[model samples]
Target: MKSSYTVENPDYQLSPKTGMTRSHYIELAKYLLEGAFQHIDSFDDILTFPLIDGKTYPQEDSPAWRFRSLEFEALERTFTLAAPLIHNDPETEIKGINLRDYYANLLYKALTPGNPNSLPMPEDLPDSTYQYTCEFGGLFKTLLLMPDTIWSVYTEEQKAAMVKTISAWGHHRTTQNNWRIFNITTLSFLKKQGYEIDDGLLLNHLQWVVSYHSGDGWYLEQTYNYYSISLFIVYTTIWNRGFGDEYYPEISKTIEKSAQKLMESIGNFFGRDGYINMWSRSICYRTWVSGAFPVAFMLENPNLLDGGWARRLCSGSLLQFVTKEEFFVNGIPSLGFYGQKDYMVQSYSCPASPFLMFLPFICLALPEDSPFWTETENDGFWEDLGDASTQTLLPSPGLMLVNHGKTGTSEIIPGKVYYDDPNYSKLTFNTHFPWEDQNPDGGTSMEYAFRSLDPRDLRGDDINFYLTGKTVDNDSELRAKFTHSQNMLFNGQRDGVLYRQAIMRQPPNNGVGYIIDLAEITLPGGVLRVDRTRLAFEYELTLGHFGLPHIDGVEATVEERKLADRTVMIARIPGRSLAFITYHGWDQAEAMTHDGNNAEADSSTVLFARKTAPKVNPKMEILITAMLHKMDDSEWTEEELSPVKDFTIQTFAPSGSPCGVQVNLSSGASHHVDYQNIDGLRTC
Candidate 1:
């Protein structure tokens, strides 16, 4: 990868640890765009070019049209960094294309009234290209932020055309959620350029965006992931920065406060190793999460994070992805996070889509003298913080994050998630392992369900289960209650909760049926899942629990014991261990190996326990306690393992208690259940 311009500015300083400077980031942005546009003959080719090798993302009514946004993404960052610096330096051409001419050609093709290759303006009824509203937002934002370079380079005729195009898009109807930010951003830019803008339209969308804010610096965008920090918070901060306090004064304050809140909660998501959480969607837009840090720096708000920490975070996250061979293929970003894995690629992804990862370089738009470039970089949260156990409850997203700093492991127990998407609805998301997609028997931290199928047919439909609802009680500080339910049929009869049927290979005389209600309570390392099952017909039931990744070189061990009323299974690696204790409704425990269960690792293993009776009682409630912990690697007495060895769960009410079980720890601390008043339950 070669940069068009050399780093000649003395003000641009490199961070000692990350080896990243403002020039290096700018060079990266330029390199990515140059690679993307290398073969393009005209600006129109951006929409029609086939950048991806293996797959062709046609521009029909398919979801692939959204990939065109990638070109705009690359241009947005390239121009954002180039516009401010080009006027000061004469040799500013990137890959033989002058900044001014390149942007003008793009703008002319996108906004020219009768040009054959011009972009489609807003239409009353959205077509295949309607999703480009976000791209338009990016375009307008680039023009607004770099007015001297973008606006000054355009002829009066071209400026009129651009304004006309933006006016139509500003008033155009868009999706009510995050898409509303498109219109808000576009109109804000138009107003800055002296266009007569409708305040009502701006305020409506502005208020609509504000409505999605879920306090403590989080916003609900399809269930809160990186977008809460990257897009929502960054957009509002840009709005406030573009149109100072003179307009929407109160809203400016709200944006600042939200940015501050996000800053406070941001450290928990980034690992000490600088890897961002891989739990959510758009994993290819890798370093965009660092966009929030730049916003905090631009706002001069130390409360969000200091310059040194921001540099460390932004540079660390950028390097974490860029330094990997799997991140880029043929100098273009691949679809997967670390490699080309089809499981992580969503329907809307295209080859150019990964360039959106350049969003963090928006910080490069800041001047060289800004603290972001000049500050002495510090070791990020991972290195600065000591060994500690930290748990934070984010109410807006209904997520409880437990960070075991010493072991460099973190677990997120999500309280509310979109039912249709299992990525967010899993029992727990661990930072060390990527969630398995479409594999019910794999990647799940804990799965509780009834498997009624032939022993030989592992592919048989094993109706999966998920966390339906969760609530935290006002009285309980450490305890949160959750409800799990699944809908199935019984004897060909449709019922919401009961499933009664004969196994496919079994005789009609051996038919079985059951009605099940499940719930869970959180613990330090794992969750205690309680399933109350009522046998409508006699059949076999099995429950499985998967522990953390067991790498190839690591020493792995599994142990099982059968007590009078419970079956216990424990799996241990070097510094961590997982124990599954089934108190009732289980007869035997066994160890199982899973092939191709991990995205990063080669193979994995799990522990499963089956209830004792082939003919279970008509109505039975089962309690299974799962404990995951980072074991103390330091040599110590037997007393050290006592807490884990002596862990016990006492069920108070099989199906009703708010706190479903009284969990006794080896440390002599006991957790009581009170199921009546639960907290944190919000309808998705």
Candidate 2:
């Protein structure tokens, strides 16, 4: 098929081929206008709208959902009302057109791509919040899609300012974890808005996106979950939009194909129900489901969307989520169905981000004359399913699967399980070992690093840690209580180990708000061994020559090897319990010098140098067995064993990374290990 944009708009005439009646196009424009207006009232006074009422508010306490939504609404409204303007007034009407000038001025004043002076971000505001990151991307899309009449109103300077601000904002520090792909596409969309930006950021964005992808049409909502199924449509569509430019034609083609696969996956999100499963944080941002379908359709061939009921799926699903009270008052989405009331609070979300659901509306960008606009909304995924099954949609590297299981419990499950690393934005949480009386300040300090698919990934929280552990007969007894505080206790009993993990809610400034623990048992004569390994996905890991592993009561023989092309490090430990710790800003932890003298003030630099790691949030199904044996059972011996249990974890560490295990071998004899390579498990 020919390019849809052209077929629909040759000399701005409606295409005869699409068979769309003018009335159909008008209806869509009207619906979008209503959406824009509905969210208009939700605008807060923090960033875009000043507290006109003249009340000062702290950044955290400021009225949320400010100008972000207003900007997008104005832009969309400008076009919705303007498409009819051109036909209504043809004589000198161009300059007199109110909607065109309104949109252009909004683009100019609100900020357009490539312009630095667009709007100044407030100094006291915390960029870590979703407001800053999500709005930029959302607004960028609205500006990118402006029609020619609206485009004609802005000065080159205004557009440039919008582009510049968005590009630079792309590098804003993500929470400890960088879920930047979502924002990078926002940056890419700005680039597509006709701005010149650094190729490095674009390349970096692509590298990270390609790296974090779990497979198929799905990317990790963040890093962990049933699997990685984030704002796939947003990132893919925006990237495809920018990649379409000739500057990177090859990448554009590849991304276009990727976009197609993404749309096909959207078809699966619909079960017998009109709704998609709610998973991960930002449950408030439910329109992501609708937005994904439209974007997939936009990037892929419309024909692909034609038979698959792409538009219907988005329209119906969006309508359902909104009617269900899942979204906030301003029409911004909710963080999730479950999570800290404060964390999942709708106030944390921005209105523009939710308008991402308008992605399907892009199909409206089709000329009023196109068949796409004329099609009835009936018979789509939402219509037929009509609230079928509430299933978790898990899109992987090559396939998409839905779990008929229950939704994630916002009510914390009482049990102690280790969270080695928990990524909220990408939606993956994991755990490894436990340290007892470990120096609180001995290790480099880290924060609650998380990312929202929205892009402004944030990472900063300072709270203290209070860890409590106990052995119970079964995993059933490990739980937590927070009558006056936010507390979490992991509870689970498997084999001989009773395990629980807890995050004691700290006063707002402790920076240490959550604690993740791994519950393990040291069987009689069984030593708990800790595995110290580094894993990477999209980026390379930088190891400072000075930092060394800190393990309690364990001797290590560390060796590095290549697994095919990737590198891995293995360290065998002979001890009952082992703890491996790595910290940031270690040089500051203790004074040191290169010559073994007082380390120069800058010597601590290695510890603080920004380093990257692979996001191995890959999913696998495996049967893990733990057995306790006599020191000398190499061949055939009888030993106590824990009942085998099935668990699903992000199983791929960097190739060759130690499996992180603690073991006790007879005083000096090393225990031999055997394992099977199962097909369909996460492969190297």
Candidate 3:
């Protein structure tokens, strides 16, 4: 059968399109739900859905059951959206399936005692896994969506069984991160149903969540990433709206302010095309990033996001994912973002995890006459700010973002990456290029080496860093607490330049150390990296230039040329050009290919410049300037193409001490970088 929907303004090249209205989204959700149910003979059969890539994830219980819960979770959002229409209009149906009967039957089968399809109850073990907590959250949410008629259909025993099931979940221990919401939401639902719950237990989770708020409207969930904002917004909004005054009045008050702060910060992550920064985990839940928008609307003072802009961003993000043909298999969303690329999946993510993308459909809960539905769509900040280049420094996250409106390219340089995950550790994240996982050596803007060590020893992998480090003084900043295991001593950023001073410990030789200093600068389409080393004893040092994205069969070419005193290595690809110019400390440049290292399966080519300290002096310093021009070859002359050549760098000290550099761009703008400053440098 033909697809039942299409998206408005679909980017046919990127996503698959079905339809664009609320009805279309509802139909799509229903279609996916039906497709999943078709594979199951009974609810227990949900444990038999095929795992993507035939990968086995470690779990005592079958993982496929999670998909069942996820499917129900997605349906809950659809049902809530359809509740008003189904109740107000008797003739309403989604894809010819009567909404009320369809949902009521499913809910009854899943929750009714002794039903073959009933979900397993929460285990009473003290160390029970968090999955049970998550599953219970979904079940409780689905029941909340039931209309009065559907609610009345449930026998008293069935309702009591659900209450007992949810009550057990509330008492069970859950993960301290986002999973806390599962307990909070479940208890809130039970309380709303007039069931008494442990007020202290509920209050404790709420207090922990509120205390976990780091700053600038972000909550720490394992590490700083997109989940910090997206999931936090959803859960807190539910708490504030459901049990605010009656349960935790203080939490309700704090969440309102935090939610607004988060809403204001979330808009920056989306590009003009509405795709979010692909820098964090759970990428399969693509449009769910728009979940924040719906949460904004649910707030009492919903002024954080304009109605027109909300619709645009929400619609745009939804379309970006839904339009991709590869997003689904047999009408069910696969375990990948656009297709079944398993590199991005975490251990906890199963085939059904992608259904979390349904969070945005919560907007369907709003009335048909709400301004969110009626307002003319606005293009959001990207369009509102015009084509001028703008930069925003998010201190809480230690992220510096530059949006080049004219070029439609945005780049983010994070000051802190606490995770070993490369998607978070990469020096720069670009909206146009989704991060790649297979090629660790490619797409990185910064890399370094140590003396006499094997390549593997010098290799930078899973380096833990964070932007939340406190500034000790004007000249030095403390490294984040998580980086204590590493040799880093002081870290600071000044005028768009990030700097660090550390003692490198050579492993296997306990006492050996090398004094290391590093600095970085990021521009719209370029980055500058510098490294200086002083060995306590005789040792060698090597520093690498940034690597550029390399896609096969798109006309790739590399050229080596001399510009004044520097040797410049330039790589040209479709619609873009990257130039790597080494000013002070490189021996040679080489082109290397990394397979499975990028977002796409195709290999990527990287250019590197290495520097080694002489044994006699054991001292070496290197500076490499990498610039990107976003225009295709046809758009510029040879002179205009080499933007890196026109840029000049002036050192603040002879040995690059204080590790300062001033870059004068061809545009006549100057960026002054002081490595000693703990706070990042201000841009021109």
TM-score of each: 0.76, 0.46, 0.80
Backbone clash tally (model 3): 24
Candidate 2 lDDT, 268-315, residue by residue in tens: 545323345443344444445455544543554666665234444554
Best by TM-score: 3
Please give the distance, in angstroms, between residue 635's alpha carbon in candidate 2 and its true position after superposition. 59
- The segments of candidate 3 whose C-alpha lies over 4 angstroms from its true place after superposition are 1-5, 8-24, 27-48, 54-100, 124-126, 138-153, 384-387, 438-493, 496-522, 530-562, 565-584, 607-617, 629-657, 677-684
Error of 1 at 501 (Å): 26
Report the lDDT tens digits of candidate 1 across residue range 1-684: 542223334332456666667767766656656665565666344433354544324345544324435454445544444554454453466557666667667766666656654555656335433645776776566555555665776777777877777788677778766788778888888787777999898999989888888887888887767777777887678777777355788988887888887777676776555566667777777677877777777673744575776777787777666666656665566777766666666756666566667667667667778777788776556564466556666655666676766556666656555443545544566665555443343223344434333221122222221132333222221111111223211121011111121121222212233334344444444445544554443345555565445565453587766554455677776665666776655666667666545555445556666653344234454544454445544432233223333333444546564224455655455544333222122123
* Ranked by TM-score, top first: 3, 1, 2
Error of 1 at 160 (Å): 0.7
The local distance difference test score of model 3 is 0.58
lDDT, candidate 3, residue 514? 52
- Write candidate 3's Cα lDDT for 164-211 as tens digits: 656876778788778877788788778887789987888787888888
Stretches of candidate 1 off by over 4 Å are 2-17, 41-91, 124-129, 379-385, 440-598, 601-622, 625-660, 678-684
Q: Tell me the whole-model lDDT of each prediction, alpha carbons only.
A: 0.57, 0.34, 0.58
Better of 1 and 3 by TM-score: 3
Task: Tell me each candidate's RMSD, in Å, in order.
Answer: 9.5, 20.2, 7.6
lDDT of 2: 0.34
